[model samples]
Target: MTVENTLELEHLEHPDHDVVVAGGGPVGLMLACELRLGGARVAVLERRTDIDPTLKAGGINQTTAEALYRRGLLPRAAEAQERRLAEYREALAALGGGRLTVPPKFAGHFAGIPLSAELLDAADPAFDGAGPAGEVGAVLQQDVERILGERAEELGVDVRRGVELTGFDAGADAVEAYTSAGRLRTGWLVGCDGGRSLVRKHAGFAFPGTDPEITGRQAVAEMTGTEGLRYGWNRTEHGTYAFGPMPGRFLTVEFDGPPADREAPVTREELEESLRRVSGADVRIQAVHSATRFTDNARQADRYRAGRVLLAGDAAHVHSPFGGQGLNLGIGDAMNLGWKLAAVVRGEAPDALLDTYTAERHPLGAWVLRWTRAQIALMRTDPHAGALREIVAELMETVTATTFLVKKISGVWHRYDLPGPGHPLTGRSAPDLALADGTRLADHLHGGRGLLLDLAGDAAVTDPARGYAARVDTRTVPAASPEETAALLVRPDGVVAWATDEPADAKGLEEALSTWFGAAA
Candidate 1:
C-alpha cells in the first residue's frame, strides 16, 4: 500500500511516518538518513531547539568513517574533518610559537605508543588512505551532527524539532506514540534518546548499571602561553589532568575528582592551578566555553528491543567516555538496525528478522561496558588503585598484549555469532573489495538487498530449496587465491551471514535468509 493510502483523512490530524525516531543527535539522524535512503519514510522528533556547538567527540575512527561512507555521507564528513583539522593545526602552531613541525608521533587514547603512520597501517586496512593528521580521528561533535543532519534532511527525512515523545504504545501491527502535541502512529519506533531517555523509561526497559562515585570535570578554555606542547597528561599530587586542542582559540582540559555541586561554578583559578600542578607550566586561562561534571556509569538496557519499540546509542547503553566509544558504538547500532528494519518495513522480510537486532547487539554492548569500566578503573588515583594502574599499563605494553587490546578497542575484532559452517566470512563484516563490476562491497549494499556472493560458478549452490533465491541476490565470481576466492554473502548491514570457499550449502543459505531476511520468498 502507498504511504498516502496508509494514512487516511482521519489519520491526517497526526503526522504518520514509516519510522518515528525519538532523537536528533548523531545516531538518530544517521538512522533516519539510512532509512530514508532505503525508501522508508522517516520522521525525527527532537526535544532540543537547536544543534549543540560544543566539541564533544574529538575523533572518528576508520570503522565509523566506513559506516558513514556506506551511507554516501563520507564527503560531507571529510569536509567537516578538514575544517576542524585546519583549526587544530592553527592551535598547535600557536602552542609551538610561530614555526610548527609535525611531531614524529603523538600519544592517543592508547598510551606510550605514538600515533605513527605505521601504527595506522597495522590497525585496519581502512586506514590506508587516511592521513596521519588530527589523530586519525576528527574533533568536534557539532561538525558530525551538522554533516549528518544536513545529509538526512537532503535525503528527505522529516526532522521535527521541539517535539518530544512522551509515551508510546506498541501494537502487533503498528506503534502508536503520544507526544506533547498529539498522537502519531508508525510502523516502527526507534529510541535514540540520550542517557536520560524518556522512550526507554516509558517502554519499561531496565537499564542495569551503577553511576560512578567519582566525578569527571571537563572544560574548554582559551590558552595563551601553551603552544607546541603536544597533548599532555600527568598524575599530580591533586588529581589527574589531561589537555587537548579544540577549534579556534580553545583548549579542553579534564580533571577527575569528587562531584562538585551542580550550582557551583568551576573557576579559572582552579583550572590554572590544575594546569600548573600537572604540567609545571604557568598557563593562563582566558574564556571558558563550558564546564560540566559527570559520573562514570556503566549501564545497558536489559534488551535493546521491546516489541515494535527499539533502542540505539545512549538509549541502549551508557558508559564512561574514556575510549570515546559512545558515539561510535551508537552509530554502529544504527547502521546495523537501519537495513534490517527497512527490510521488514518493505515487506521483503518477516518481522522475525528484527529479533536479531537484540541478539547481535546486546552482548557487544555489555562487553563494551565492562571494558570501559576497566579503563576508567585504571585511571583511578587512589594509592592501591595507582599501583594496579602501573601494573596493568606495563602489562599492556607487550606486543602480544597490545595487539590484543588494539583489536578489542578498535572494534575490528568483533564477530557476530551467526549459525553456519564457520566459514571465514561467517559472522565477520564483509571486507571492501574491488569487485569484477568495479564496485565495492559497500556499493552493493546501496540497493538494500541481501547479497549472495558465489566464488565458484555454481547456481545450484544457492538453489531455492524452501523459499530462498527470491529473497537474495546471488552472483558468481572467478576462483582466486584462498584469500581472494573466499566468497562472502553480506547483509545490508555489512555483516557476512553466509560464505564458503565453494558455494554455500543450501541449508546454510536457507537458514541465513530466514535469520536475516526472514522466511519470505
Candidate 2:
C-alpha cells in the first residue's frame, strides 16, 4: 500500500508500510533511515510536533561516530565539530597570547571521569585519524536527529509527526497498531519510543530491572551568586554537582531518591535548589534556559523481539547516561537491525534471520546495564564508596587502566561472537582498507549493501557474490600492504562477518553470505 504525502487524513489507505517506527527522536529517525536504505518502505510515527534541538545527549560516541561516517554523514558532523573548534580557538586567541595556546580538546569522559587522548587513541585501533579530525568525539544529538530525519525523508520514509503508538496488536506476520492519530498496519513495528515504551509494555515483553536511587539533572541555565562554584565535576559530601565549560550549562546528581514526580518539567529554579543541595553553594538563579532530568533507572526488556513487534534503543534497554552511551547504544541497535530487517522485509531472508537481532544485541544491552550499575556503585556518597571512587579515579589516571573504559565507551571492547570465526577481525568493524585509488572501505557502504573486501585479489570470491550481487557489494581492491589482509566479507552495518587471510574459502564464504544476505538461490 502506498502511503500518501498527506500526514493527517481520516485514515491511512496504505497502512501496509514495511515498518512503522514509533518515535521521531534520534534512534527512531536513524532506524527509519536504515530501513529505507535496506529498501523497506517505512513510516516514522513521532508524537513530537518538532525535532528537539535540546543538547539532551552531549555527543555521539565511537561506534555511532563510525556508523555515521560509513553512511557518508560524517562531513556534516565534522562541520559542527569544526565550527565549535574554530569558535573555541578564536575565543582563546582574543584573550591575548604571543601564540594562541591551543585549547584542550574535549577528550571524552566516562561516568564523570575524563580520559586522556593517549587512553582514547589506544582504545580504538581502527581510528587512523584519516577521516574527521579529532578522536571521533562529540556530535550534538540535535545534529544527529536533523541529519537522520533529512535522510529518512530523502529515502521516501513517510514520517508522520504528532502520531504516537497507543498500542499494538501483533499478528502472525504483521502488526496492527493504534496510535494517537489513527491506526497503522505494517509487517513490523519497532518501538524506538524510548524508556517509557508503550510497545514494550503492551507487547508483554518482561521489562524487569532496578529503579532510580539517585536523580540526575543537567541544564543550560543562568544563575546569580555563582562565585566559588568551580566549573567542572565536583564530588561533594552530599553528592556530585558540576558546572559545564560554558557558564550557563550546569549538571548535578542528588541521592535524594528519584524526583517526587518524574513527569514534572525540570526548571532553572529547581536546578539551583539541587545545586545548592549538592554543592552547598549560595548560588542564586537570575534566568532560565532549557533544563531536564534523568536517573540511573536501569532496565532492559527480557526479550527485545515479540511476535511482529520489536524493540530497539531505549525501548530495548535503559541505563544511566553516565558514559553518554544511550545515543550510541541506540544507534548501534539501528545499525545492526536495519539491514537484517530490510532483508526480511524484502523476502530475501528467512524470519529466522531476524532472531539474530535479539541474540546479538541482547548481551550487549545487558553489559551496558551492568556498566551503569557499577558506575553507580562507585559513586556512592558514603566513605566506603568514596574510597572505591578514589581507586577508580586513580585507575583512570593511568593510561593502561583508562584504556579499558575508553575501549568499552568507544565500542571497541565488544565483538559479536558471530558464526565461522576465522580471524579476530571477524565480527569487528571492517578495517578501513585504503585502495590504491584512495577509496576507503566505508566509501562502498553508502548504498547500504553488504561488502566483501577482496584484498586477496582472488577471483574465486567474486563468483559466490555474483549470486547475491544486488545485496552484496564485492570489491577487490589491491592490498595496500602484503600483511594487511587477504579477504573479508563485511555486512551493511560495517561489521566483518567473515574473514580469511588465506585463499578464498568458498564453503565458508557461501555460509556467511547465505546466513546474512539470504540463500544464494
lDDT agreement of model 2 with the native: 0.80
**Pairs that collide, model 1:** 95-227, 95-228, 96-227, 96-228
RMSD (Cα, Å) for all candidates, in order, is 5.0, 3.1
Q: Residue-wise lDDT of candidate 2 within 262-293, one digit each (tens)?
A: 89977767888888888888988777667788
Point to the candidate with the largest lDDT: 2
Question: What's the TM-score of each model vs. the native?
Answer: 0.84, 0.93
How high is the lDDT of residue 321 in model 1? 70
- Candidate 2 Cα errors over 4 Å, as ranges: 1-13, 86-103, 118-135, 504-507
* Model 1 C-alpha lDDT per residue in residues 21-132, reported as the tens digit of each score: 9999999998887788667888898877679754477766555766766556666677777786777677776766343444333234542222233334355442222222
* Candidate 2, position 430, lDDT: 73
